[model samples]
Target: MKPDFNAMTRKELRAYILEHRDDTEAISVIVEKIKADPNIHWYKPEDTDRFPEIFAEHQKCREDARRNQENQ
Candidate 1:
């Protein structure tokens, strides 16, 4: 039986998605989660000047998440 993607943590879901890249349902679930995040920032084509700052923040978030996951 397949695991419940909706019940998985962000880290668990990410690992599952990596191991099961063909699972459209899991991908859709992750996409929905991302879309539902209130902290998500949308960048426009004209916001080129802010791209570096935006990407740096994104990288920091990824690193923080990795550290938190490791500590767990």
Candidate 2:
């Protein structure tokens, strides 16, 4: 008998995938559940005011690294 994927938690589903790599149906169910979950956000949007300052700092660091590389 096939296990009910819908009843499994994300961790259980992941373990099931590792154990049953050939089960495409189980894989599909996991993908669909994750997509349907509203709380499964990968990245939260940062505050815009802080974001620009952080991005500018990152850009400056990258530019400095590139200049140092070119000088070497």
Candidate 3:
């Protein structure tokens, strides 16, 4: 199930990824959603109120997939 970014907390989002980190395709879908929103992922030093661990993990998944495809 996709975590609704508007409704879920950062901690919850992180936990969601921890459970589903292996599913890169699903994460990609969510990443696209976040990217489309823009405001949901404004990262900066002042970003104490927002957490981006899920976003980071999604990026890492995409990068790993690219590397794996290249290696193949």
Candidate 4:
């Protein structure tokens, strides 16, 4: 009755995990896939010097939205 995780896309696998948190086998498959995937890498701040400026702009947008919400 169990679904085949190997046949599923990453998004489908994630959805499966959310629906079946108790399924350890599916969780293991996702974890292993992530670990084995060379393309799945962490971001380093030095790699993107523009991150601070981009983050600041994001924060300003959030603050402006919060203020608008408060005014409405």
Residue 26 local lDDT, model 4? 94
Model 3 per-residue lDDT at 57 = 62
Residue-level lDDT of model 2, residues 23-47, one tens digit each, is 9989999999998877443344655
Q: Please name the candidate that would achieve the greatest TM-score relative to the true structure.
A: 1
Which pairs clash (backbone N, Cα, C closer than 3 Å) in model 2?
A: none
Model 3 spans > 4 angstroms off: 1-14, 40-72
- Would you estimate the TM-scores of all the predictions? 0.64, 0.53, 0.32, 0.54
Model 2 CA deviation exceeding 4 Å by range: 42-72
Ranking by TM-score: 1, 4, 2, 3
What does the lDDT come to for candidate 2? 0.84
Residue 51: error of model 2 in Å?
10
Each prediction's whole-model lDDT (CA): 0.89, 0.84, 0.66, 0.84
Regions of candidate 1 where Cα sits further than 4 Å from its true position: 52-72
Error of 4 at 31 (Å): 0.6
lDDT of 3 by residue, 1-72 (tens): 655654665555656777988867556656766677644545577665445775676688779879999999
- Model 1, residue pairs in steric clash: none
Sort by lDDT, top down from the best: 1, 4, 2, 3
